[model samples]
Target: MSTTTTAVINLDVPGPTISRHVYGHFAEHLGRCIYGGFWVGEDSDIPNEGGIRLDVVEALRALSIPNLRWPGGCFADDYHWRDGVGPREDRPRMVNSHWGDVVEDNSFGTHEFMKLCELLGAEPYVNGNVGSGTVREMSEWVEYLTRGDDSPMASLRREHGQDEPWKVPFFGIGNEAWGCGGNMDAQHYASLARQYGTYVRNHGENQVYKIAAGANVDDYTWTETLMKALSCLGCSRTPNNFFQGLSLHYYTHTGPWEDKGDATSFTREEYYLTMKRAARIEELVRGHAAIMDCYDPERTVGLIVDEWGTWWNVEEGTNPGFLYQQNTLRDALVATVHFDVFHAFADRVAMANIAQTVNVLQAMILTDPDSGALVLTPTYHVFEMNTGHHDAQQLPVHLKGDLPTREVEGSALNLLSASASTKGDTALVSLSNLDAEGPRTVVLDLRGRAVSAFSARLLGASDIQAHNTPEVPDAVAPVLHTGIRTHALGLEVDLPAHSYVTVSLELAP
Candidate 1:
């Protein structure tokens, strides 16, 4: 016998339109994420478009990625833009001191990065060097990319190949000033953020959204201090000011950052622990948003969850600095939980970016060098399935019955997480069943709204540890879910265990 659960959802009562930027991805200078993972060189046998892997491009394009945060996580703060421009051969070689202790040839630089964004049709969110670079260097870097007229930086850009200025939508002033970006206290980083941001001027038609480096997990003092600093500058919950975004960095892990558990295989206890950690993001955002509310009640500045994703012990023999890990069904559920939280706070949580897009922690696409194989992770399918919710108006969803909890070892975990959105005549419902043992019945009360047609795709696995390997890339993939049924009040769908499912319905026949 199957138990029933009803969720009340009214499309007329909309909350906020989920910003497409919430679905952004990140690419860093760390590991093969930029080199072997994305760029394989023009002379290499790997299939590529202008040195970038064509297969990787096509895969990311499928997600309709809104924006891409690039250059670094820590690498961004120390990175000098000058070292990356000019001829590829003449570009100075340097040590990647931040990641892997490997040598960087400066092969893929500013122009190459911009070209990749052009290919993917994505907006580039460039991070300036604050810890190691000067204010002039930071200002010139922006000028080179966005300045339209004939100036020093603009002239240099033309000499480098880009004749016309490129429109840069988002610009992060620094990375983690609390730690990697700089070892500055809240007041110090706040001072530098304002000074550097002031000179980073708007060029041509490019209205760059300035993002200040924000807090780490549970660092309420940092958010409070930064907001207080900006508030002192007469920047408080208003449009057209010194700060447009404030970023926070957090990763989901069971233990300390050093011992984040395994990637592919794990105990049932670890599984529940992972979800428990995922829930911490809500606490972090709420606490930080509350601080922002105290400072900027108008909610002009966006709470940018710029860096987030699953972090685990590096694969068996992979370089620890590379931060590579396999994506499994558990990660898919983790991602849906994240999107659910972001959607719930869509009004103020303006944007978010997964840690690393290609080969780093919790990546969407995995690329193999030996076989030159390209595989889409289960998390990738979650993003693909939820693409409809992008820019869609978020609707209120009320669960009538309490969520069924399952005891894994000694941990009690709630079973379901969901969010609803509507775009014109179409309504999309995203559901996640975190239970690893049995299926879940989710009865949705559509509030007298009749659906003319309904369809869904589920990203699931029989085993929570199941993942895609190079040889069997299709081991876990999305399939059409057919458990949706209509009854008296509304409809109910049988969500399989360990699955992230998206339902699409057309209300008008």
Candidate 2:
């Protein structure tokens, strides 16, 4: 029998309201991501804002990044906020034991990070040290940032130069409690979260968002323990508040950490497997939400996938710890699929940050500091292409037929993913064609919605391994699409194989 496949996208059914934080990026003090990639020192020829590279800032601004998470991934637990304050020379030089074992000068501290956020017009989501630090340490850190009074920490903040307190709303109690962030069980971490959260005071007009370290991928037991424990905390007659959001971390990679697949070159099987892992995020979010539902049926708690993206083997000759990998159409496809999934569960998944913003796993920006060359990766294109979904009301979509599914070990994942949004008189539809081989023509059923004009943009490559380099910058960028139009029934567009397409339509009068 000859095989035939098609995709049907319904623009009538919308998803949840997409959070602005979904467009967030992460900047950790690991590898060269901060020093070489972003920070170039104020004295250098490279234009900078308090030592942060201006070129890098402009590039991130183009992405309209909503928020930037800072100061550690695994390093957050080991960091002491005080060490990063005061004079640059007076600051202690500490060895980064988790990352490269290199000495860090503590130049880029809390002040520098908030300054960078301000320059980019992005919100700061600071992760606190809980594994090695005390409750006083975490509480004082919060006071130093948000407190604007004569308190000890606030006084210290003035003494440092900033007389006024910074506006830092999002604070993570800890990160990855199961691994580098203190080897503790869910119950242990939950108790630790409660203690740290109780002391994390919100001074001034800034509202604090306390995030608890949540489960890894598919670790349902952790979520179950967290929900049950936090529920008890919520039910406390003493009136105590513990957490505002639960943080989850997951990476989409085909092989083990040591043997992660190459970023630029891969066979069809590898591409298929990588996308399979990417699509699993939908299942992960749904499963985590199910646990949250059992405990908090009112949906008061938020699910924050704080760390996510494609993690693969490092580029040739690059330091493995540096996590420098080439971005390609494959990564672009991965981003589209993940974003669509997040939108589907937008009510529960409030925020998510791509892992290691620049010069790291599936990075949106890559820099050659020596040559002063800055390049946006394929993943960046995906973000720019789908920016319409940011803060847009989710429109419901209905698919009449079954979308093809890929089977893995007796499990299956839908081949096509889609989401829709409407703002003002314009309706936007973004879809991902996850099929590896032939193109799929999707009949976009608009459900009798008046459509005046329509246009589309597509990011795809002839081969799955196709990538853009400094020499060939436009290898896999988005092409301005003009194929589909609005009819009385709907619209029809042919989605190229392994492509992400965004269609914008003008509502008719």
Best by TM-score: 1
lDDT tens digits, residue span 1-509, model 1: 45656778896677789999999989999998999988999998988888988888999999999999989789998788899999898989989888999989999989989989999988999988998888899899999999999999999999988999998999998899988888899989989988999988998889989999999988999988878766743454354466688999989988776688998889987898888778668889999999888778888789999999899999998999898899998888889999998998888899999988998999999988678888899889888898898999998778767577766436666677889999888899998888777788888888646688888878887899999988888778998988888867667788887787888988863
Give the lDDT of residue 148 in candidate 2. Answer: 89
lDDT (10s digit) by residue, model 2, range 419-470: 7887767788887878888676667777545777889998888988788777
Off by over 4 Å in 2: 1-15, 232-240, 408-411
- Judged by whole-model lDDT over C-alpha atoms, candidate 2 comes out at 0.83
How well does candidate 2 match the true structure, expressed as C-alpha RMSD? 2.5
Candidate 1: count of backbone clashes, pairs at least 3 residues apart or interchain = 0
Give the clashing residue pairs of candidate 1, or none.
Answer: none
Give the Cα-based TM-score of candidate 2 against the true structure. Answer: 0.95
Off by over 4 Å in 1: 232-240, 406-412
C-alpha lDDT of residue 8 in model 1: 86
